[model samples]
Target: MNSKMLQRQLKKLNLNPEEGPVNKKEWQDLIKLIDVTYNEYENHLYRSHNTLNVATDELQRLYTELEAKSSQKIQVLDSKLQNIMSMAPCIIMWLDNQGYIEGCNDYFRQLLNFNESLDNKKITLSDLDLHTLQVRAEEFIKSNLQQTSFTKQIANYYFKMTLNKMVGQNKISILGFDVTEDFNKQNTINQIQAKAVQSSKLAVLGELAAGVAHEINNPLMILTSVAFVVQKHIEQNKFDQLPEKLEKIQSTITRISRIVNGLRTYARDGENDPMMPVNIADVILESLELCVESIRYQNIEITFDNQMTIPAIVSCRDTQISQVILNLISNAKDAVLPLKEKWIKVILRQVEKNVVLEVMDSGSGISLDIREQIFQPFFTTKDVGNGTGLGLSISNEIIKTHYGRLFVDHNHPNTCFTIELPLA
Candidate 1:
């Protein structure tokens, strides 16, 4: 409680050094106030110094943590970008303005079969060692410098290359995409379609087999008769009449050849044949020749109604279209065979921009429940062992390929198959 002691404490506490005289009691009270003030100042100084030390330590730790995290983030981003460049299924390269390879990804290295690092080799369009790339390098460089994109095929492999000019730099980013698998797949699909077309032709031939035999048989009988008459004329010494009989024999042989030729055409493979303007009426008549015999044998009255005398021309594959008409006529023959009053009528006419041919049979009409499904593959109303069910389906596809239509006339009095071909 002494003033001297209080002054010493105040000096230690860095407080003001001035003091005043007073009574003993007052002095004691002042001494107590100075001690309390000194104690508070000392505690505040201790706390401030301790707080600064703790803050400094924490800031150092935060700085170290921030440095570590920033480095790690940068490393991860770099790795991700490198992986993207390497894993891309394309040739990515940066070329200088002089058409020299500046940089390229792993894909480019692997594609061009570069065993060593790119730095070891001076790769340029002028001297690319790869055979395939060398052949196209000059052309590719020309197109790239012109800022044009193009597609090229090397052997069975195809590529689509794009070039982009780098802004603020004398460089171009070239991207070569491999489209070989897609191209090969498309070629495979085309082959399959071609086979399907051939199968359709064979199916048509199978349906007309019996009728074709009967057609050829009738001509054979006429030729035999003409041969016997010519022999009789020669034996009777009828020289004047020999010319007429010889003429008959020639005409009969010609008829037989005509029938055989028609059958041979229908049976030929026409999948690769080019489209041409065909006489629609002549094709119909030819189809009838192959089918009329069998139709007559089934006790079906077969009639051909031609509303157009001049040949109705349509743009189509001649033999394929004939197969379509033959298929329809064969189907009509089979359909009318089961009916008590059996008849198959053929009508040809030109309506608007289309030439229409209709084959109508006096048989039970197609049911409404199955009408929509009739053109579907393997759908038939006939017995299973007797029908392959592909006749109508193949015919429909052929007509569609010709840019025409083959459909049942639902409003007709009988089961009628109508074909509308575009007129040429």
Candidate 2:
């Protein structure tokens, strides 16, 4: 007898239960074939289920390994970031929207002289001892600027600070680099350069001493003649000519006063002078007053060509600029004094947004080999005792400080040094 489930399946397959099999042999063969098919189907189903379970287990194992690796990589990156922040040579700080200290790196803490960690400390900008930084930070916060930079002095150290506002966040970051050494070094260099410039001025004065003496002597002779004439008039009781003679005397004295004043102004230290907008033409004229007499005494014809229709106004230290002009004029005089045709011409003009001043002499242009080195400190073509070689170098430096350019105009027909300064 077959099982009840198999008998029902066989009945459904059109084998009637009430009527037995027509052929007993064929009926048994059909039962055997059905049993074989059912077994194959059950084995296939079990293999598919087992494969699915194994695949699920593999997927879980891969996911766990990926997570572990990701976690380890994150830890490594975090450690590196921490080390970089701690070892950096600059001050780094973060602040909340309300200007309260949020966090800072080790350098920042050390800069502020903090003895304890600021992890949970509640501190405001004003609560710190940095008054200037606090004030500037407040100003920056109040401004619409997203970032700004400035220099501040704290105790004995100087710092160039940069402040930035984080985008899409109510936070500010402050970065600072210690610049005390650089600042002090620059100041010392400026001082030395100032002295060198002053010394150069004095040297020029020494060269002009003879011409200055002659210049003053002429006016002195006129004064003396006028005084003698006035004395004669007083003795003769002729008061009418006295007024005219007195006017002449006054004019002569004024000329002498101007020469002396020019010398005094040129000899002073102008290193710390504030920059002001001045007419370049006026600077040239004033600079000429100090050396014009000297040039004329050497029979060197000097002329000024002011081509600008308007004032060539430039922002600069006029005194320092005067020194540059004087240095150039002195150089021009030396260059042409030995030549038969001696002449110096100063041309002032405006080019685009710049004021250009050219000091040209009646001589062949400088050779290319030496032109490149003319602006180097302690490089000169003059006799050993005749030149300090710092004039051109100092002049170039001064022009640079004024945000201008000084160079040799090799294209010109004559030897010329050009100064190009931005218009004020």
The whole-model lDDT of each prediction reads 0.77, 0.86
lDDT of 2 by residue, 211-319 (tens): 7888888999999999999999999999998889999999999889877876776787777889998888987887787778879988999999999988899999888
Give me candidate 2's TM-score against the actual structure: 0.74
What residue runs in model 1 are displaced by over 4 Å at the alpha carbon?
1-82, 90-204
Give me the runs in candidate 2 sitting further than 4 Å from their true place: 1-90, 105-111, 116-122, 138-150, 162-169, 350-354
Q: Count the backbone clashes (under 3 Å) in each candidate.
A: 0, 0
lDDT of 1 by residue, 324-417 (tens): 8887877777777767998888999888888888988897678889999989877887786766677788789889989999998989878999
Angstrom error at residue 2, model 2:
21
Clashes of 1: 0
